[model samples]
Target: MWSGEESSRLYALRRFVDVYPTITKPDRHVRFNEKMWTTTFVLIIYFAMTNVMLFGLSGQALDLFSGFRSIMAGASGTIMHLGIGPIVTGSIIMQLFAGAKI
Candidate 1:
């Protein structure tokens, strides 16, 4: 009873899944100190990236999502323009797959 569009969508999703890489276990267990140091380093890098300005762009663009800045944990017009978008998108995809029992 599924429509043609639904079937086509399923086919596309199947093709994507076929090409997706399998998750591999980490080579070794991470110690607490190592994890903390890594976290600190990443945070420092993220903060530095957010502070870096975007070049070669006209200043005419407006940040409509300025209100959501606090929520996004990102500043506009920088490398963090779409702050945490990749992380959030990845989380959403993982949740969707988990919901689908994939």
Candidate 2:
């Protein structure tokens, strides 16, 4: 349980975090070229990132999410280790909040 001051501070922190530009479904339709270019760029970045191995990771270290590799789109012990996890999670949270009218 949080004290009153702690709760207020937490609320403020939440507010601060929420006050950022989020990737929302656009009000206006995107042009085909724009969509294509955006997608291509993102894919290029993702693929490039996948090839980047993390430094100082020992080969003998175990991957905790090896089973979920296909679903997560990340390479074990690489820069893409968290692959799409953060993006997917944030999307789900936002969708849930929107559904709940929060």
Which candidate number would show the highest lDDT if scored against the true structure?
2
In candidate 2, what are the lDDT values of residues 1-102, reduced to their tens digit? Answer: 767776665666776777777888989998999989999999999887877777898757887888776786767877788557888999999999999999
lDDT of 1 at 40: 100
Candidate with maximal TM-score: 2
| Cα TM-score per model | 0.48, 0.49
Residue 27 CA displacement from its true place in model 1, Å: 4.5
lDDT of each: 0.80, 0.81
Error of 2 at 38 (Å): 0.1
* Model 2 / residue 15 / CA error / Å: 21
Give the range of the ten consecutive residues with the poorest summed lDDT in model 2: 6-15
lDDT of 1 by residue, 1-102 (tens): 767776665676876887799988889998999999999999999898877778964447787878776775777777787457878999999999999999
What is the C-alpha local distance difference test score of candidate 1? 0.80
